[model samples]
Target chain A: MSQIKPKSIRQVRAQWDGLFWTTMSVFGVFYLALIIAMLVADFRFTNWSDMTSLLSDARVRFSIWLSLISCTIAAILSLWVAIPTGFLLARLGSESMTQRLGQRSPGCRRLFNWARYFIDTLLDIPIVLPPLVVGISLLVLFQTPVGRWFDQRTGDLFASLGYAGIRGITYEIPAVILAQFTVAAAFAIRTMRNTFEQIDDRPERVAITLGASHYQAFSLVALPQAWRGIVAAFTLAWARSLGEFGPILIFAGTARMKTEVLSTTVYLNFQFGNLRGAVSASLILVTLAIIVLVLTRLITLGGSSNKGVIV
Target chain B: MISVQQLLLRQGDFELSQISFEIPSNAYAILMGATGSGKTTLLESICGLRAIAGGKILMDGDEITRTPPAQRQIGYVPQDSSLFPTMKVHRQIAFGMEVRGFSQTERNQRVEELASSLEITAILDRYPRRLSGGERQRVALARALSFRPRLLCLDEPLSALDGDTRNNLTKLLKKIQQSESVTVLHITHNLEEGIQLGTDHFRLEKGQVRAVVGKDQGGKNTA
Candidate 1:
């Protein structure tokens, strides 16, 4: 056996401090260039004054309001659905249920793995598919018999809820929100499931022995332990919803003071040759997104450092 | 309090065959065995955590081989303490009661008494992560006993402790078992612990019991 010499203190320190800063600086330059391009191509500091004016526009107000409401609904829906999906994936990840199932029937393991891969591929499908394709697909639903039936039933419910008739594409805010959820939820579930996977399963087992049923163990024990990861998933999903362009544009067309979200408003204003109006909306959207991202990053970092259960 | 008759478990390469054992009510039985022995498996079978391919288990004269671990009225302290780190000492001790639907007042009272008795009262608010190894074991014991289980199964409970802590805990455990008269099936590979606390001893060797014909021949048998 050979005795390998250890690195000197200086050598170890150089690897830690020197390589770390160099790697960070390289990525920092890339981020800075991206930000600079956004500023130069869209809005410079000179257009700052126009931001408040754009904020006062009725269409702009509606765009902001629509963005807020739709994203809020999408975020809430994504969290609600993703938590259970993530938890189940994490819990079942280790179980030989598939193995046992596979034994009972040959090709069962292959079928189970194929199904898991198929679902995983579907999740990534939303990520890669163009927003326009999403929008067009959603619009095609309106042309179907099922779509017509849904429209009539929903219109009746809206009427009973004290709203006027929801005729055609003119009243499809909920559809647009759902479209966002379909895409956003995939990313949310993927991230959350990864986080849940990192947690040990022993805690959940202990909870069960302590008298909790399976659901009780999950809700009280596993969920709280994985809360930080779930929060990170939520923030990332919310950001995705905020920046959505394709589905919202196609499914919920750009109508002034109607379906005008921040992204759609920017696009519409740009087409009208209202460069300043476009720039102002773009500027606000960018600013709002930056603020949101920073705030969420802070919250996520805070959550990462948090120990034990919230309760 | 607990009895097993012809319990058999087989999993591919490993097999436990026709294992039978009985512990008198209120007796402390230490399952002494070498590594690869079926000591842990036997305990798991009794608690209904593992299914026996063939056998019958009875708790208080009721056949409970098919019963789930949670419904078995048998509390198990796993080898690693297995405390829920997210829960405070107080909540951890009271969790068994909460699961059984005990009222808040009764649960809290039991928790208080157990904490004081176990000398874990000051650490009630602390998480399991902060506790020492011995403290964790004590909390695990308290949590198990708090439910007033029909039996207590300690699966190498002191194996994770340091030398001094293991010795101290062995004494503490013996005191608790005698006073509470909790039917105990304590598993250990340590000969010293087996002798110190065992009212009855069952030695397992490769899925089979090396039955005690007499004390003179006890230490010589091998599977």
Candidate 2:
């Protein structure tokens, strides 16, 4: 008997497959094209010769520098928190902590479940709640005694260091980083948690069996494999911090040449009816975002050769 | 010698209870079980990777029920070769010794010796991804045996190899076991291979254990 599919059957399958892919390609490619068109149109209306001077403007430069510095610092801190937190969440005994606690007592199990539920819900609050809500929450937090005490201690240290640029910890560079971290770290945590969850725990276990301690196993087996995911997480957090506006504006007041970041510069320019300046700043922001996005893609693609531990 | 008494473990819905066994020092014991019979679970428990509910694991006269896997000094090769992809073969073999605070010269000497014996000396610089399945298994074996573990746990070590490769490796493994005299807890579905190597035979069914065959001091079947 002939093994090949019948010509009529093949034709029918090909026809349906072609139609499905064509429909998918039409909408998918067009939406992406529209965004590209709009961005290109923004450039088309601009004067190329004046672009350099627009970017080199003192206020613009200061805003960009501030945004860069703050976002970088925030992202570093976010990763520091995210890596460990994400791993902990991912490794929290897939047997269910609540179920394991059942061995203790029924009441303790209930408490464990509630605690787990509360923590999980809290993780997504930054992403689920409105950005402005995060800003308002931070403002409300700093008014409390605990926050005031922390602020005073940090403020005292900075004041003693003779830094005239910083006023108080609440309305300065530190506040900017904190505001950015609150939101960016949430995204990074989700990313890294998913990464760790996807990875099999067998290699780490094997490492431990081979005379490596808990920390050694994690460092040797888990961390090395998690490098790509960590890079991706950092890229996302940094990009998100760059675009964060509400929390920074609400928590850290935009003081010109002090706390004024790029996002606030765009807002202030638009408010002052400096349409040209606003558009210019937005374009710069878009360009920077694109660079970061492209860099992440390249890094992911380049590191695709190593598939991590087999299990 | 390693001994397990009244071991109980629950993983999700599966319950392995009242498991008991003893493998004498420098003896090869084969644990035979069907699919989902909790053989791997028992091996992991022995290595201190699994949480046992009520049990005692005595190693060389020391009660190590709560010992960490690192302190247990039990080398484990899981069913699938889970070689760390980022490391070279040498690094994988040396990882144990490095973590155990062995000096550079000792680590290098042991790694090279194991690599040569395992026929992976040429591929020591190669990453796990570049190796063949059989080669990966050999590297895993080298890594497991590098630190001179008190007991070696092989979780279906030959399951992934071809007939010829499996036969050759079985002979090689037999030779290594004889020379090292490290207590072995070998899990396998291959009955013939088990009978060939095992000084003691144990069967696990529905999470329960039975002494199918026991061997005497002279390695003769006394079941």
Candidate 3:
């Protein structure tokens, strides 16, 4: 028998490294291949004629328009809330807070810490909850006496403003926007918070010391630096709104040409055995998602390396 | 004159107790401390960025302990010269005046004056990210002095520079201090820096601050 030579440490290490990388690549490529397969399946199932046919349908066109309009409105509202909420959360646990709370009793400090944690967890509830559950919760909430009272007030106000056909918020066109905002705003808030955190707080502090108020410092120093993050947050919110189906299906109810967005259009077509239409709609969403992803990447890469958006 | 009396500050488990110091008007005071000695904390407390547990800060005999930072009219240049990355040098220097509702003409004039004085007029239109380290420090200094604050606080403004740049900036700092006649409290770790620029010297150790007499007086402590 020929004597076998022992493997050198370097050789063994190289072999192990190769095994590790191959295993990792297997798992990574598997997911990527699955995504590609999904796209391929979607494309193979739907032809260009399917797209043109769907576009020809007034209801489908309305769905596309609703999707664009609702997602845009949801994104704008999300940004309105996200910017302030994110800034507050980013500054909440900062060193300045420590100094501010240092003079208080330990109990007070503990209470403040608990409050911060509680608020943070509370904000994350929408992001973590099941999409269907969020819709159900909104439905239930609107059924409550307080919700009904507010809804009645808003309905009367809209009537006074000459939108005589306008009704309450549940299962209406507004419901789609509300449902999308409920979920998308949470993601936007998270993105904005991370964006603010990545930026140096020292500049804001310096601004304050230079005779700028907190609002001035934030608007002038922090807000200007956070534009890329804003873009990322807006794109994420829009993409998320575009894909939001479960909440809309439950809360908004696919009322064709009124509350039916693209997501619901896909489902409505599938329910009616229109596989071609459903697949085409899904392809449209997929294309939009790809565009959003590319845009987010470009924005992130174009940003300053030190304070790029977390998304 | 700027004075911090019996100051107490806390961050997490770290505390600086009964810290007290005073810098005379137009004095170039240097505060020397070890790393993590709460030097920045003390500076921030004085600037109203950080709250103090028990202290009264007086600037020109006015009690400003509870006063907001903006109203305190104190210019602060933090370590790393935290310039606004989005704004060009001109806007960075004009930020304070702009916020205070200065006219466009006045803002332009002030920005131009500070840029000329700081020798950063060449980079006026350039954003901070494009500037060199020394240029950043100069821009920060210019921004701080733009509003002609009565007191200027610098946190290790020269620590990040090389030997030649550090020496040059040190000389510039002295020249600016004299020309502006603004009281300054400069934080540094280099004793040579303290000796070269400081008319009043203080050292922070173990969260306590004590005055260090000048070399002419044998470097004794007035703690």
DockQ of each: 0.38, 0.59, 0.78
Q: List the residue pairs that clash in candidate 3.
A: none
- What tens digits encode model 1's per-residue C-alpha lDDT throughout A175-282? 667777878888888877877777666666666666678888787777877767776677767777888888888777777776778888889988998888888887
Off by over 4 Å in 2: A1-7, A93-114, A303-311, B214-223
Instruction: Give me the candidate number with maximum DockQ.
Output: 3
| lDDT, model 1 | 0.77
lDDT of 3 by residue, B1-223 (tens): 8888988887768899988888999999988888999988888888889877887899999999999999998999988899999998988999888888889999999888878777889999998879999999999999999889999999999999999999999999999999888999999988888888999999898888888886443246877
Docking class of 2: medium
Q: Supply the DockQ value of model 1.
A: 0.38
CA lDDT, every prediction? 0.77, 0.84, 0.89
lDDT of 2 by residue, A60-151 (tens): 78989999999899999999999998888877744433234433545756676687668877998998989899999998999999989988
Chain B TM-score of model 3, please? 0.96
Q: Following a full C-alpha superposition, what root-mean-square deviation does model 2 have from the true structure?
A: 3.9
Model 1 alpha-carbon miss at residue B40, Å: 4.6
Better of 1 and 3 by DockQ: 3
lDDT, residue A143, model 2: 90
- Native contact recovery (fnat) for each candidate is 0.28, 0.73, 0.91
Report how far off residue B50 is in candidate 2 (Å): 0.8
